[model samples]
Target: MSRVLVTGAASGLGEALSAAFEARGDEVLRTDVSYERGFETGASAPSSTSGGYRLDITSDDDWAAALAHVESTWGGLDVLVNNAGVAGGGRLDVATMDEWQWITEINLFGAVRGTRTFVPMFKRQRSGRIVNTASLAGLVHPAGMASYNASKAAVVALTETTGHELAAYGVTAHVVCPSYFRTSLMSSLRGADTALAEVMSKLVDESPVSADDIAAAVLEGLDRGDELIVPDQAARDAHALKQTDRATYDVVMRAQAVKLEEGAR
Candidate 1:
């Protein structure tokens, strides 16, 4: 069985993924910002054999500590799943610099840090898997979620690039582009201002997929050695749209923008 490390293991998709791996007899090291709570409530409860760590993905020091702990305890990691992220709401014009920075730091930079930090270790092993959690929003430019979309899109690009570079080492990289999975991501969506909360809420409610389904898709993709894992039917449809009709896709996204704004009001 593979030795796996999953970030954002406190709840939602991360927790589920950790459990899935553990159930298959793989050793899992789960990490999140809330160590005690996540361990007691999410990771440990589902699989007592899995280890837990308090990890702040935005901090390089924290990543170093976690990596060191894993190396000391497990010898080497076979899979690294960068599953931690946050969602932000608002048009690009209305988002504050701080807000954009905060989201990107976690959603984009967090994954980059993990990949950079872990690649050397994986190279030493000469075989490993890196799974980056992106979103359907990355493929289709949705309105009022510019920062979130951009961060996920960056993940897709990073995963593709890293996959190419790591091929010679037998280390495979996979990008998971999931449609709205039922997770705290929606609950955490930051508004440009308080007034935009209603619009964000509506958008989240319309999402068609669940975290469990996405987790299943992720496992399947890993098994199949797929480079891009579109987890849900809606996400697959969106990806196909981007490939088939660029102008029509733009028109649909513009209409979504109008709807989002009207919902906000």
Candidate 2:
């Protein structure tokens, strides 16, 4: 089995991913900012894993500690899953500078930090995988999600570039661009637009898919060596519509935009 490290493992997609990797007999080191916050805020932390540690992706020190832990505990690494992120969005002029910075720092820079820290180890081993969790918004770019969409889209680009740059060294990079599914990700949602937030919340709550379903598809995609994994039918359909029918795509997108405008009013 592989030796895997997952960030944001306390809840949501990260929790599901950690379980999925463990179910496949891989040794997983789960980390999350929540784990750190538990100590800082005096809240109850989640059940401890054998090698799990508190990691705040925004901190370089935390990233360094994680790498040290992996080396000391596993002796080698196989997969690095950069899955920690917050849910955030706002319409163009409404999004605050602080919100943009917050979303970008975690959603985009968190992955970047993790990948950078682990790349040296992977390069030395000459075999490793980087799995980044982006979102369908990264590709589809719907309305009222400027910050979130930009952050996720940057992740997509980072993964693609890493895949190309690391291929010769036997390293592969994969990005999961999943649509809204039942996940505690909404718990971390933040934005200046309350209306947009509610709309996103409804979409997430009403989705027919679950985190487990996405995790399973992610593993299957990894097994197949897929670089881009769009696991859900909804995401696939949306992306396909964008690619094959631009006019129809614009109509649907604009209609959603109109609804957001109405909601904000």
Candidate 3:
């Protein structure tokens, strides 16, 4: 069984992913910013065998500790899943510079730090995979989500670059861009735009797909060696339209923009 480390593992997509990996017989390390918050996995707390770490993805020291733990515990890592992220965004004019910086630091740079920390080890092993959770917004920039969109887009770009730069070493990178789905990610939503946050939360709550579904699709994408995995049908369709029919895509995006303007007024 392969050894996998997943960030943001206390709940939501991260929790689902950890369970999914465990179900498949792979050993998983479930980490989050606060282990005190506890995992949904029945256990009130993490045990030594749980391999859970309180990883603040933004901290260099935390990343170092995580790398050391992995090496000392598992001997080596096979997959590094950078799935921890927060939700926040607003129209370009409405989002503060601080908000942009805050979201980007975690959503984008968090993944960057994780990848940078493990890549040297991956190169030494010459066999590893990096899975980063981006969003459909990364590919199809919707209105009122500038901060989130840009951050996720950067993650997509980072994953792509890593794939190319590490191909010779047998290291692969995959970025998951799923549409809104049922997830606890909404809990971390932050922005000056409360109206937009409410709208985004509604979309997430109303989505028929669950985190488990996305996790399964992600696993399948990895199996197929797909670099860009748009797991949800809505995301797939939207991306396809963007690629094949710019006019229709523009109409759709513009209509959303118009609605946002109308709502604000």
Candidate 4:
């Protein structure tokens, strides 16, 4: 059993992962921006095996404190899952500067900081895994999701680079590029610009996957030491499109954009 640290563990994929790891007898440290009432209601943070804490992934000081706490208590961390992210919708031209900055700060920079902080710890142990949560958007350009797609694409690139850099230290990195999963992620998208929110709603209605499936894919990828894990059929297809032909890929994406625009109307 591994000592695992998962960010964004309060809900969605992060919560699912924490539960799955704990069920498998791993010592799991779950952290998020806030604690769910269910976990906090009369449930004391565990001392030995399972635990939870509040963590703001955007804050470097918060990241430092959380890592220090985990290292002090667990002695070492065997797995680090950077799963915290925010969704940004709408066309690039219409997206506000604040929106772009916010998404990049958390979705991209958060992963960067997590990898930078725990890499040395993993190197010391010389046996560890880093799982970065990217998305199918990272592999393909999706209409009206420029910020989200760009941030995840950065994660994919970072994971590939870090995987090679950490290989000599006996550490491996896995990038999870999952398709749309049924979760609060969709609801969260509602917080985006009004027009974009409507578009996101239709996309969510069309997607056919769940957060649990994504959680399973993550574990499977780690077990197999796979660099890229596309959790669902849609994600696999998206990745394949990129492999097939650049011109064909562009044509497909453009068709998708037209479809989304027509649907929104």
Candidate 4 stretches greater than 4 Å from native: 36-51, 190-192, 260-265
TM-score attained by model 1: 0.91
Question: How are the candidates ranked when ordered by lDDT, highest leading?
Answer: 3, 2, 1, 4
Candidate 2 local lDDT, 72-191, one digit each (tens): 657779999999999999899898999999999999999999999999999999999999999998999999898999999999999999999999999999999999999999999887
TM-score of each: 0.91, 0.95, 0.95, 0.90
Model 3's alpha-carbon lDDT is 0.90
Candidate 4's TM-score reads 0.90
User: CA lDDT of each candidate?
Assistant: 0.82, 0.90, 0.90, 0.80
* 77: Cα error in model 2, Å: 0.6
lDDT of 1 by residue, 90-207 (tens): 6767889888888899999999999999999999999999999988877887877778889889999999999999999999999998876667766666656544566556655776
Given candidate 2, what's the lDDT at residue 121?
95
The residue-level lDDT of candidate 4 at 89 comes to: 63
lDDT of 4 by residue, 1-265 (tens): 8888898887889988888788779888788888543233324433224456767788787778766776766678899999988777677666788888888988999999999988888999998999999888898877878888899999999999998998999999999888877767764552345676776666666767778778887888778879998888888987887888878988887887787667656
Model 2's TM-score against the true structure:
0.95
- Flag regions of model 2 displaced more than 4 Å: 36-51
